[model samples]
Target chain A: MVVTQTNHLAGTEALLERGRDLSTPLLRAVVDRLAPPMDTVAAYHFGWIDAQGRPARSDGGKAVRPALALISAEAAGAPPQAGVPGAVAVELVHNFSLLHDDLMDGDEQRRHRDTVWKVHGPAQAILVGDALFALANEVLLELGTADAGRATRRLTVATRKLIDGQAQDMSFEGRERVTVEECLEMEGNKTGALLACACSIGAVLGGADDATADALETYGYHLGLAFQAVDDLLGIWGEPAETGKQTWSDLRQRKKSLPVCAALAAGGPASEKLAAMLAADAKDGDGEHPGAHEDFSEREFATRAALIEEAGGREWTAREARRQYATALAALDGPEGRAMPESVRAQLTELADFVVERRR
Target chain B: MVVTQTNHLAGTEALLERGRDLSTPLLRAVVDRLAPPMDTVAAYHFGWIDAQGRPARSDGGKAVRPALALISAEAAGAPPQAGVPGAVAVELVHNFSLLHDDLMDGDEQRRHRDTVWKVHGPAQAILVGDALFALANEVLLELGTADAGRATRRLTVATRKLIDGQAQDMSFEGRERVTVEECLEMEGNKTGALLACACSIGAVLGGADDATADALETYGYHLGLAFQAVDDLLGIWGEPAETGKQTWSDLRQRKKSLPVCAALAAGGPASEKLAAMLAADAKDGDGEHPGAHEDFSEREFATRAALIEEAGGREWTAREARRQYATALAALDGPEGRAMPESVRAQLTELADFVVERRR
Candidate 1:
């Protein structure tokens, strides 16, 4: 199933290329202008250099946020180029999260290379994350509302949401139990808010009416939720090469992923058994490592996965994601979704499908 | 000595009030619009609330950046109000650094309370810090190109310097050895860049010519260095009640402050002995216990502090700070400085003196 979607996503390269066409020049200029001193350890975290200060090759990411922002903007009737500032802003925010997330998760690997904190140390990584965030804010401010007082209000509101979402996500890390509803709320705020912001900001920049902006925001929000659902699926069942990491890695990390929540929500024998497994994994043992679990034997792992599937975890999520994608499509219910000369709406629909269907 | 300076700084509260008067309304407005839910954590850190999320009196900071900004702008003949955006931006940058510095130093206490990380946890503290940085950028965008694009350019450059300086400061943490030149350069970037940024941004906003902006930048740079030198002195020799932390705490923490650099550079019998003490303290046991030095014999500590003073470190740094302060004052030589209204000039001069003399 993952392989089929991966192949389809490959066909979206042209859509992504169009996004790059809109985003790259502006992003490059921002990066060039804001590049820190070679001596600053945080510079190494940006993947521009090695730990010893030697130059490196492309420190590139998939540019997912940029593509999402641009597609949503175009789907809302604006030309793709109009969303360039927002595309760059969202991408910076994503990268900032990656840098700090690496530190928090203690994952020393990112992009098939040493994570920022692994190579440059946590302090430097923290600063690099900070610099990226500062740049994102600068990008917004750089595109002022022609009215200072009004613009300040909008940007500050958007920024506050971004920060709040991040706080909630981080606070969830050590908690032993969380509900499906809680996880959805977290994803909605942390990941979806920015995606919604990208679309809303794009619509505003495109001079759309308030109704159109709200619709685009809804479309982006639902799309982001669908994207996270797909991501959760990939984390558990992804192929190593496709996912760019080990399979079932989220499970290894004992993350409270969506499927796990679904199993919990089912409240059957499997749910109770899984809860015990999770609780035991989190407990500290006397004079030994407590996170190491002895209860979940290999046979039990297989049964647990089967029970999760039986409980309608992955299937339920996938169906819901498709429904949300359709809803996002419906929200564009006007000339904004259909009027683009380039069949831009079709491209956006395909991209939305790609987000929820991708294995990795 | 530190007590006297604290008393003097207390007297300058009226001047600080004047600085707040320049931009408090806009700053407060921005703070208000920071949006709720997400701002709860940030508000707590800023001392606007208790940890449980109840509102309280706002804990005041010196507002040094805003003060310097307003002073520099007015001295350059720009209306102080015209530079309020720049003032807010610099203050935001200053606060951003403080948030991260507390994390890096592992100093759980800040402003006589638990630091952001201690209260909200590191991850949330990190996000809050990033949010402030983004806010700073938003403030910069508000400045617009009121006088061509020069102010934006100055701000961008200054922000980069602040990041570089902070990066350098963090990088110096793990190293076993450092040179006086390296330490000075680090301090210049860490403490000086933002002060320089405050002045440079102010002058640019005030519509100063390139030459006058450069002069303000120079003034701020030197002033910051002198201020840091005085701070380093008090860090080791000042009273805890005056400095708001333990006396000689920097020495206990093995910080590479200016006086320590001077002592190391002296490189005589006392210097060698001090070196031996530091080396013994760092690696004398199995490398497992860096903090085990808390158990160091009293005789070892007295000998180390004595070696530091006997090397003429304290006196040398004090004189050097005075020299730098004089140099900073000299950098204010310009048409703008000469044109300042007598009242404003006196206030600005007194503010500079107050910064140089601050004990904490």
Candidate 2:
């Protein structure tokens, strides 16, 4: 099993590398079209340059979305090149959201570097994000094909859902109680919609019929949920060295992540204790203690995390991730998936596996 | 001359009314696609509802862009209905910019109502602006025609220029001097590009060829300059009631608008004095007197306004507006313009005239 997992990781890494190789040049070219300051800021955000405009190689997060786009094109029986525009567009959108989300969430760092808003200021962050979004549509529609129109429509619909998800997430921060169902719906919209778009946009661009694109979208949607579940798990219990975040990072922000919601709904003694603790925290934090997370001791956070696990939050989330992974794989066995090249199917399966197993 | 001016005003009002009538329902329908809080916020921003989510009749800005779009379709020998999608898309982009700009500019009120960021907070402002932008592209691409693809490209390109212009505008606020040429370029991007797109997008949707769209685009580009020049005049000189802003509004904000740039370029004792005063204002406002405009006496603003006018700034700006208005009209007599129906050409001419003359 260990050997098989190692091999799968290697294959997925190769796929992601291929995606970055195919999409980065086009992404850079489009970003270059923006005027000076915005272009400089975008380059800095993309990790191609330092804040002072010097060249630097920093971590630009995993190019998983682009890989999905390329693989979807291949599944549609087209060369990966056919998916390059979709890959570039999806990457542009992903970064656009990052720039804005960093500002909205008051996150100062990303990928171990200061965020655009932190370095350049909030206005540039907003304007650069807007410019990137415009570039995404331009990249797709400039293709001037019917497929390009279809792809653009798909991308925009997914973008709206993504925005809706962000709204829901922000609203969730102020509330102490969020149903497990509400948490799942938000995650599905936030991460799932864009990933679903990335997985199928290239297929649409490559002349895949609606049925084929829908099947690929389904595969991606579940993969995103599984990926997000793992992410929630890491947010609580993962190693800070590997995740590049503090222990209980989500808890520090009082995020109503899937595990927290699940644990709250467990309805046991530990769950009740956890609920009372969080409610008190929320009340104290309301106006009395701004930045209250800073006041918590290491032991207190550990206690809360222990209570969450004891209430079966961690187990439930892990099981949910596995169930989602299985569902994503089952999408490949559907009628449309069966029509795709077997090699493409195998690659997609490996990518899904990588998603749930990723450390960061 | 009085009767002719009255007739022109009436004609333009009718055109604007027609534009609003046609675009409002579809715009509302598309906005409704946004989830609750966003949809509510957007509706409030559009003046369809009040702050408490109660129904209210308020001024939505003049639907000038949509009118231009509908007229462009008519110029292409298509009915106004053919331009409905273009009209809706252009309005969405316009509001998207307004929402973000109000936040960045820190303006509290617009059209006699509180700005979105003022009422809903900055995060919602950013998110809703983003959602509107996504909807704009979605509305166009969902048409699923070759014309829709072409139109989407035009709109996205214009949107990029708009973002670029905004970046330039914000940068200019930090500096004491800006050249007239640079000012024109910024306004051309900020206001002109979207207007140009609006004027041509409907033509594209109505099957106009590149040459025809280009001519109409040129017309709208110059018209936008004229419109902005008139707006700059109102910002400094118009009555507060008519303009829905305080007297010397732009000066209070220290905007390096066209008139200021032109006056600074004019090289005279008055110009020199004006430049020195502005430079000192910038220095004093830097960190020592944040929000220093609140401390400026009415006499000081009046004195500055007098200096700008004495240095030929006001005259030059007014003359520039006329120059652009004439140039816009000349576009209608160009080769492509000559092919448009005569009535359409006349309406475009009247619209350009009205743009230069408007008080608000």
List interface RMSDs for the candidates, in order.
5.0, 0.9
- Candidate 2: stretches off by over 4 Å: A1-3, A287-294, B1-3, B287-292
lDDT of 2 by residue, B1-360 (tens): 122788798899999999999988999999999987999999999999999999988999878999999999998899998999999999999999999988777777788778998898888899999999999998988888889889999999999999999988888888889999999999999999999999999899999999999999999999999999999999899888887777788888888998899999999899999999999988877622125487899999999999999999999999999999889889989999999999999889878877887877
Docking class of 1: acceptable
For candidate 2 chain A, the 10 contiguous residues with the lowest summed lDDT are A284-293
Residue A132, candidate 2: Cα error in Å is 0.7
User: In candidate 2, which residue pairs clash?
Assistant: none
Give the CAPRI class of candidate 2.
high
* Model 2 TM-score relative to the real fold: 0.97
- Candidate 1: residue pairs that collide: none
lDDT accuracy of residue A17 in candidate 1: 73
